[model samples]
Target chain A: EDQVTQSPEALRLQEGESSSLNCSYTVSGLRGLFWYRQDPGKGPEFLFTLYSAGEEKEKERLKATLTKKESFLHITAPKPEDSATYLCAAAGASNDYKLSFGAGTTVTVRA
Target chain B: GAGVSQSPSNKVTEKGKDVELRCDPISGHTALYWYRQSLGQGLEFLIYFQGNSAPDKSGLPSDRFSAERTGGSVSTLTIQRTQQEDSAVYLCAGRGGQGRSGANVLTFGAGSRLTVL
Candidate 1:
């Protein structure tokens, strides 16, 4: 069974603090790993798609790195605006195009 | 709209009543998807439609849940005998072909919040 798990269900970070959220998965044939940020009352916004191990992507103060077993979303000097729920999902190579997602990690960057 | 659009941003209903949610995918997008998100939870795949292909309804939780896509453009999700457990945000997404290798990203709508009392 394919499953995605995100750890540290909730995190409270002081403004400008650096932290990393974890996403571990078990899939039949890895196709893609996705990261999304969701704010209250809205759908998730795309962040990054990591296709292979040892790959990394960055945007402003956010960086995402992937490995064979898991992926990490690293927030550098996160501001209060960065506070949101981060989601992780995995898509297998079955052509279904369905993504299995984790429960998400809620981060609160207090100012 | 340039982005995916969903109707009735908020719906409050009594248990056992049926509810329908609509989604209008971005124009020219061949792939459409529906998902459910509970409070503080990740997305739960509900159904998918790609071009003229048959929709994959494997993720639907029960037989009372059904969806239809008309002309491969707009889609509707219907839930019968809604229960409190069905309260959640329903999200719709559209995916366009980015390249020949099937590299595409899903653009999501703001979502419709369903509250079953």
Candidate 2:
């Protein structure tokens, strides 16, 4: 079974603080790795999709990097609005799009 | 219309009652997905529908959980004889693309919060 594990279950940071969340995985064959941001009471919003090692993608204050065994989401100078649970998922070798997700890291940015 | 939408934002039901949740994907989207989120658990994939083909229901936990997509646009998930463990937020998403690598980003709905007592 493909498995995803995220570190630092909860993170608290002051406004403008920078930190990184980690997502490690083990799968038979990796088709894609995905990053999503979810707010309380809402569904997850897609952030980035990394297909190979050394691949990186960026948004306003977030950067996602993927390697053979893991993916990382780095938040730079985060604001209160940036606070949300970060989710990481891995799609296996099969054509099916079933994604195995990690428990997620809850981030709270204080103003 | 613009994004994936789910109906009945909140549902409170008796433990033995059945509940049906609905999802309306963005117009023209070819793929639809269902997931459940418990208090501390991560998002759990429940089922997936693509075009007019058979759905992938491997993620469903039991026979009590079933879903159907109609007209390739609207989908419904029906849970029979709900249990306390069934209390969670159910989310839906839509995707479009010919392949996994080319699949468009998934757009998610606000989710339906189901509380069984």
How many collisions between residues are there in candidate 2? 0
Residue-level lDDT of model 1, residues B1-117, one tens digit each, is: 778889889999999999999999889998899999997677888888887464587889999999988887989999999999999999999987753224356889999999999
Q: Give the runs in model 1 whose Cα sits over 4 Å from its true position.
A: B98-103
- Per-model TM-score of chain B: 0.93, 0.93
Candidate 2 regions off by >4 Å?
A: B99-104
What would the per-residue lDDT of candidate 1 be over residues A4-81, giving only the tens digit for each residue?
Answer: 999999999999889999999997677888899988878788999988899999999999999999999999999999
Candidate 1: DockQ?
A: 0.64
For residues A1-111, write the lDDT of model 2, one tens digit per residue.
Answer: 889999989999999999999999997778889999999888899999888899999999999999899999999999999999999988877643778889999999999
Worst 10 residues of 2 chain A by lDDT: A91-100
Clashing pairs in 2: none
State which candidate has the highest DockQ: 2
Query: In candidate 2, how many Å is residue B46 off?
Result: 0.8
